[model samples]
Target: MGIYSISDLAELTGVKTHTLRVWEKRYGLLTPQRTDTNIRYYLDSDLKGTHAGVKTLQQRGTNFQDSRNDCGRDGGGM
Candidate 1:
């Protein structure tokens, strides 16, 4: 159970930090934990949702909302 920073997740997932933030804000793709300082941190489970892979997390459609709809609650394809 490793905790990861946004940069770490971006590096591991090959997605930019900006995009990761957008996804979290727009799509509810990630559920990062907040520290007392209000800093966001990710977990190994965040990197890999239930059964969804890293590639799945990186897949985005024209608009994030649409992609999110397709990528069910677990961020896996419907």
Candidate 2:
């Protein structure tokens, strides 16, 4: 399994690194593994799950611009 840094994940998911950190802390959407040095890293499944959640919310009428903001404010995941 490959692990990705925050920047890599943001690039892969089209979400900002700050937003990703917010999601990680607030929504519990991602559970990145910690390296021996305590650096955070995510697996491919994390990206896939985040993408799936984004798609689901889009289908539910949550615009991309608003979804992350809403999620951050509401503390809701998925």
Best by TM-score: 2
Report the C-alpha lDDT of model 1 over 1-78, residue by residue, as the tens digit: 899998888788766677677667767768799999999999988888622644453463234345655666332222
lDDT of 2: 0.77
- lDDT, candidate 2, 14-34, per-residue tens: 767877777789768889999
What TM-score do all the candidates reach, one by one?
0.65, 0.76
Residue 72 deviation, candidate 1, in Å?
18
Model 2 residue 32 CA deviation in Å = 0.5
List candidate 1 segments past 4 Å from native: 50-54, 57-78
CA RMSD (A), model 2: 3.7
Model 1, global lDDT: 0.67
List the global CA lDDT of all models: 0.67, 0.77
Best by lDDT: 2
